[model samples]
Target: MPSQDEILAVILGGGRGSRLYPLTKMRSKPAVPMAGKYRLIDIPISNCINSEIFRIAILTQFNSVSLHRHIYRNYHFDNFHTGWVQIWAAEQTMQNADWYQGTADAVRKQLFEIIATRAKYVLILAGDHLYRMDYAAMARFHWEHNADITVAVQPVSKDEAHRFGILKRNPNFQLTEFAEKPHDPHLLEELVSRDDPQKPYLGSMGIYLFRTDVLVDLLNNYPLDDFGSHVIPQAITTHTVYGYDFTGYWEDIGTIRSFYETNLALTRPNPPFDFFDASAPIYGGTRFLPCSTVYDSKMKNVLLAEGCCIDHADIQDSIIGLRSQIASGVKIDKSIIMGADYYARTDQVDIGPIPMGIGQNCQIEGAIIDKNACIGKGVIIRSFPRGTDLDFDNWVVRDGIVVVPKSSILLDGTFIGPGSKD
Candidate 1:
């Protein structure tokens, strides 16, 4: 069996999260604020730390400044600890002048740096996913099976199977074939890897554990752009590939709707993914701020972070992020209020006409109020109808969810969503 030190973790910070735009417009996908306080990148990094696999490298390409800052401030290892986390951004080099084409290409460009780590196995992860797994267990599975590549898979229903890379495995759990988002019913029926009728087909989770030697060989020979689109299918034919079934809560929050729903889901009595685990706690930035203060507010099922002040507001089933300020008579429901990055200096009169937080008597529901947005007095923001996709000067309605972009200014009495006449 291989120890945790023998494996290296490579997290792919996806390229230009177009699906999660406006949020990804300013920061990288992983850097997007998640669950009120933590960034999406924190999930994978925290999992690695909890599993005692800390020699990690994140491959980033687009909009990475904020992502880089978060990593630098949160994940610094001490001198005594042998483990370290580093970022490998796409660059123009003498060998290659293009940006990362896809997942495999990103890793391929950084192959020399990865090879220098000299680890026996490489664990690849996607940064935009929400899940908790003991990767050390996966490593053990790979070692026990003597597998060249092991993909972490989850079962999807027949209807949902077409949206994923379906896998077929033999009785011994070794992968025999692969299908990339096959829509044909006959094809899906043939690819069922499990006995369950509801979710019989095994879908790839975009998580792969590769023998270092085998990964090097494949990348050198395949010259493919994507791992799911090209590499894994080819590896099934030439190398010993296996499937590791993971039966747990996993979500790919790569789009606005998924991200919105996932954030609000945390406000439930029992969230699908637990963050309160003491043994495997999710790590994040240590901002030494004062406790959140509320005054005569009616709140329920809300996840409130530090440095927030809610005054006479009615908030339910929402996530109020750090340094958030909600004035009196404000009502927020099923929304994600990503609070301001910094507090508005009260001492400075030069602060703009509209403050940096939600103003008095504002009504926000089923929306995502991004960081540093100033919602003036009596502003209204709500979810639009299904298939509602429109872009305004300061906000965007995507997938029926109204999103106020970062550092936007919604003037007093501004109307958005349903009843608004823009």
Candidate 2:
């Protein structure tokens, strides 16, 4: 097994997550909050740390202020230990005047620094995925096979193959052909194996392992700007590329619907991705807050974080974030309420008619209330009656769920449902 010191992990923090919409309106995709308490970047960072790979770099470009702050404040290594996590934001220099054109381009821009690390292998990962992986095992697989590039792939359904890069591997797991989002059914069928017709296609997980020399040579020589789209296909013809099959829970939280579903899944009795694992725990910033106080509230299947003050309310299958303030007679179900940044002071005046947090008698269902939002009294956030998408003054109906933007205020008696008019 290769020592952790021989590998350098680089997490690719993606571009403006337009699919996640209003959530990414303020923060980068990787910096987006998840499970109430942790950021999306924390998943990969935590995994790398747990795998004993300490030297890491996060490559970010769009809306990186919050991402930078969270990384700087939380991750620190002692002088005695050489392990450290750092951020490599996009910059314009004489050599490279443009921003990161694509994933491959991002790494090319930072090639100088990457080569400086002097690591034997490079592990590239996506920042917005949710899963627990022991990368050391993948590294061992790569070494044992003597593969030039090893791509971590998962068996996805045939219907979903169109959304990801599909690959065909031989009996030895050596990648023979690669297709980026194939539209033709004939080509898709060719990618699948003859043995298992059910899971015919192997979708690339955007996780890659490469020998240091191979990675440097490919980036320096190829004009390709994307791995799945360009580099991987070309490499299959010349270099030895292998696919490592990963059978585990992995979800790319790229779209709003996926993000919403993933969060709600945490309320399940036994979620596929468990955060309660003692051996491989997720790490985040430690916020010193008082214990949550629930007064006369009827709650079930809720993951309430620290510093929450819940009054007489009914909550079920929800994830309440830190310092969430739930008032009396509020009924919440199948919702994710990201709590306020700080407590609303008694003397602090409201910026609008509604104060911060969910107001009294508000009935919210299948909704995602962003951080620091103010829901006024008697507000009803539910699906539209007419099943039509509506973007109101305070919220928007996305994937049939009410999404209240960060710091938005819904005025008193605001009723948003199907067929809401302007």
Candidate 3:
């Protein structure tokens, strides 16, 4: 039983997330924790669920164990008879090589499953971003225009515009040109209508709505490879690829700095992303825990999730993850602590300290520490997590990010510094 106008959505979650290094060293980018509470993939899934699209298949590869576990534990929906949210991992039986090479190839290999569903449109979206959108409305717009492909576009600043897949559209909303990370904005404006392009140049959100047969044929007979590299560029001239104007909050968390900034953006008094929307609620796995408690702590502008304990610590502009514990007199500012075992573990690879500290009396200066560090009392640790100058005289300077492996235990009274020994 299928509706004639139903569209299938495919969430692309196969990137190696190398830019989010250290953090992504163990977990996939989509599964990485965000705002100290939700995973990166939750944003898109919540959007899809809120949009009332029940049939979804998350395509994952490359360090997908954590991502798979996260979806299974939190977002599996079994209520709808025809709605099935499935996960498609790269299988050796289907491909002679490793995991998916690119976004287009990821879907092309599994085009059969999508075709079998008999959906009219196939929606492809990226899972590594922070945004709240009504995809259902976007889908309706696609049908309203009878477009071969409808891409979500938003306005970006001139300096940052070059980093995105900039779109050029006419008054009729048809895309005339598509360029990936172009250097010149004026040149990009050439593709736009003469009227007003620079003031509001369209940038692709990587959220595409493709006609089922069109997508199938493109995957079958298209001479090119990836979507951005081949598909969209080729389709612009031959097909009616319209640009759907979307004026919502969209942040691409491609690098560590961007990811950190996006998380901090949520701590604002009124965040752009309202996860509690009543009409389109972002669904998450149920957690049974009491809300966080702060006692004698000087905390400001921080987001504390349930099952957390903060005691006598100075915290500002930081995101505390689920069930994490911050000990008394421990001061943390401009840092991200994903796990809570920092104060109890003893096993660590110490090189030198630009900034590292521990113990009840330890005073830590400004710097980053990864996670799962054990510091004994009365030690001063700063942001410089590793000291590498001693080994090669070329210190592994702290990128202002302290990364500790998961569940690392620290012994009391141990002094470590800015770099890593391991």
Candidate 4:
């Protein structure tokens, strides 16, 4: 059996996340804010910790400043512990002078450093997913089946099958065939793993477990660029690959629409993915900030983070992030307010006339206000119909949701969305 210590997790920090645009404008997709306080990268790292897999490496190529900073502050194994978290950014080395071509190439470039860990297995994970998984259990299954590679798969419906790499498996859970985003009706039917009508095909969750030696060999010999497009298909033909069924609430936060829906889903009364699990708790940076203080706020099903001051606000089905300041008469519904990085002090000079956070009497609906956004008083921001995409100086609409990027400033009485002037 594979012990927890013998497993090294290598989380892919993803490419230039063009699908998740303005959110990825300043930071990488993995570093994007999630739920209220945690980041997308935090999910995988926290799961590794909970699974007792301590040796981890994060492969970052795109904007990774925030991701690196978060890891430095949040994850620190003490001197007594042998565990360590490494950030392997893309570098132009003597051998390779190019950036990470894809997921496989990213690991191929770092194979030298990864081989030095002397671990028995390597767990490949995606950074921009929302789920809680016990990787140790998957490791045990990998050992029991004596498989060279194990891919984590979840049952996805035909409607959702077009978005993921679907696979067909045998009764013993061995993956027989794999197809990347098969849209044809005949091929989709052939890929069905179960007899269920709703969810028939098994979609790859972009998670793979491999024997360390086998992984090193495949990357060295194949010269492939991607796992989904190239590597996995070849591996299935050559290696003893198996599928581990995962029936959890797994979501890929790859697009603007998915990101928006996933964030708002957390505001539900009983969310599919809850962060309050004490046994397998999600970990993040420690700010040591005071508890949020809400005075005369009519909030329902809102996940408010720490260091926030909400006074006389009517917020419903939303997520207010850390250090968020919501003034009186603010109305926010079905939105995600990623709070400021720092609380602006009254004594601080050079700060603009409009204060940080939402000003008084602002009406925001179905929008995502990124970090450090300064919305002035009487600012009316709302959503538009699906397929409505427009870009302005301060904000942009992608998939009908208004997105105010980081450090954006909206002037007093600025109107956006439905009836607002561009």
Candidate 5:
């Protein structure tokens, strides 16, 4: 634990991740299940462990108790004297400000707790991304440049540059300009001279390295502005901010489409990202159970986590979460079900409403059934169930979204209506 150590890690896990909607409705984004088993929080936590950076803190709020419990049970290492990976939840007190305002302000408020442990530099990372990165190398790049702030940059298409922070960097990799979603002159859009290999611009990965003292000072007067919207761009005029180009398997699984698409990724032959690679495995906390069992079920190219029970069903291109149960004669296709339980019991017996269940002989075609919902047998739930195009009170969705509410029951052979899915 020397003063000259290259890095410390801060995981920004406080956001509600509302974009993920029903997935995040009950759990924080970091706690959302990924590729069948791993929670979103496990990504950065595992990355830090595998990359040889042990001391880290997860800053969490908004349904964080579950996220906290998962981290406590799963993230473990045996050989560290001064290194520990843990969490930092908001503590409402008499003097300090309450709750996190934003990502930057969250760190700004927790300076004492972070500094209490004597970390030299703070590496800020997000909790919702899915990628395998050697952050140790990225940190080394930061130290070599003596950068006041170092941002991980990647080359992105001009159309996609609007989706992220765009940076204009000089030949030396010194960032010249940063735009938080520019209208035109996209990041990395300019053509490089035929003789030069460097691209036009670099897009920020929303990952950054900040010198401890410099970060504290800058955040102190940061005026409640975010790193992307204000701190990064403003710092470019004076502070030494550099870009580190990164090329790897990285995706922000923050939206429903992205989540579904990512699940569909595993089905590809020799996919770009493989979770089962034992050598470079993305370590998540192992559930205390044997591998998932499939009985009388037809499964193809799906990712099923431990503790799952599948019986007499056809599941394909889906991500089933931990401890989930798929009953007989059901078909779940191209869906993402996160460790949700579908039992036949609940407290909604008054109006005959009950807990969730997707029953046998049911066709849940390209639809989402939220947690705790009970769908009866022989039911057809879909935006276009049979393509019958029948004239019988036909249901037409606004965004063509269909959802089965949590803790509700659809009677046998019932047809549920649709609206914006998320």
Candidate 6:
């Protein structure tokens, strides 16, 4: 097995996440809060720490202020240890006067720094994925196979295969062909594993392990910008590329619908991804807040974070984030409420009728309330009967879930439901 010191992990934080919309309005996609207490970037970073691969660099562009702060504040290595996590934001220099064109381009620009580390292998990962992976196992697989490049693949349903870059591997798991988002049924069938025709096709998980020399050569010779679109296909023809099959829980939380559904799934009795696994635990910043206090509230299947106050409310199948304030007579169901940044002081002046958190008599269902939002009293946020494809004043309905943007304020008695207009 290769030592962790010989591998440098680079997490690619993609460009502005337009799909996440209002959530990405103030913060980068990776920096966006997930599962109430942890941010999206924490998943991959935690995985690396668990796998004992600590030397890392996060390549980010687009609204990186919060992302930088979160990483710096949360991750701190011991003075004696050489392991460290650093952010390498995009910059315009004389050599490269442009932003990252794609994933491949981003890494290519940082090749100098990566090579300086003198690592034998490079592990490239996506910043927005939610999963737990032991990268050491993957590294061993790459070394045993003597592969120039090893791509981590997962079996996805035929219905979902069209959303990913598909690949066909031989009996030895050597990648033969690669196609990005193939729609043709004939092509899809060819991509399916020969072992079981009924089994789902092997789709790329966007996790890559590359030999240092091979990676450097490919980046320098190829002018391609993206790995999925340009680099991988080209590498398959000339270099030895193998597939590492991974059968685990993985979700790319790139869109609002996926993000909303993933968080809600955690509220289930048996969540696909377990955060309480002692063997491999997810790490997040420790905010020493008071324990949540509930008063005469009926709650079930809820993951309430620290510093929350619930009073005479009925909350079911929901995730209440840190420092969430819920008043009396409020009923919340099947929703994700990302709580406030800080507690409202007694001397704080009320900007409107409602203060900071959910007001009294407010009924919310099938919605995602962003951080620091002020929802006034008697406000009803529910799906539209006609269909949820409309944009209201402070929120937008997507995938039948009303999403209240960050720091938005809804006035008193605001009712949003089916057929809601601008």
Ranking by lDDT: 4, 1, 6, 2, 3, 5
248: Cα error in model 1, Å: 0.6
By TM-score, the better pick of 2 and 3 is 2
Candidate 4 local lDDT, 1-422, one digit each (tens): 55999999999999999989899999999999998899999999999999999999999999999999999998999999999999999999899999999999999999988889988899999999999999999999999999999999998987889989998999999999999999899998788899899999999999999998999889999879998888889999999999999999999999889999999998898888888899999998789999999998899999999999999999999999999999999999999999989999888898898899999999999999999999999999889999988888889999899999999999889888787777
Model 1, poorest ten-residue lDDT window? 413-422
TM-score (all chains, Cα) for each model: 0.99, 0.97, 0.85, 0.98, 0.85, 0.97
In model 4, state the lDDT of residue 226.
Answer: 95
- Tell me how candidate 4 scores on lDDT: 0.93
**Which clashing pairs does model 1 show?**
none
Question: In angstroms, how far off is 207's CA in candidate 4?
Answer: 0.5
lDDT value for candidate 2? 0.90
**Alpha carbon lDDT at 47, candidate 3:** 83
Q: List residue ranges in candidate 2 displaced over 4 A.
A: 349-352, 385-389
> Between which residue pairs do clashes occur in model 6?
384-418, 385-418
Candidate 6, which segments miss by more than 4 Å at Cα?
350-353, 385-387
When sorted by TM-score, best at the front, the candidate numbers are 1, 4, 6, 2, 3, 5
Number of backbone collisions per candidate? 0, 3, 40, 0, 9, 2
Instruction: Candidate 3: count the clashes.
Output: 40
At residue 296, give the lDDT of candidate 5: 83
lDDT, model 4, position 322 = 97
1 or 5, greater by TM-score:
1
**On a 0 to 100 scale, what is the lDDT of residue 408 in model 1?**
92
Q: Give the residue spans of candidate 1 off by over 4 A.
A: none
Q: Least lDDT summed over 10 consecutive residues: which range in candidate 5?
A: 389-398
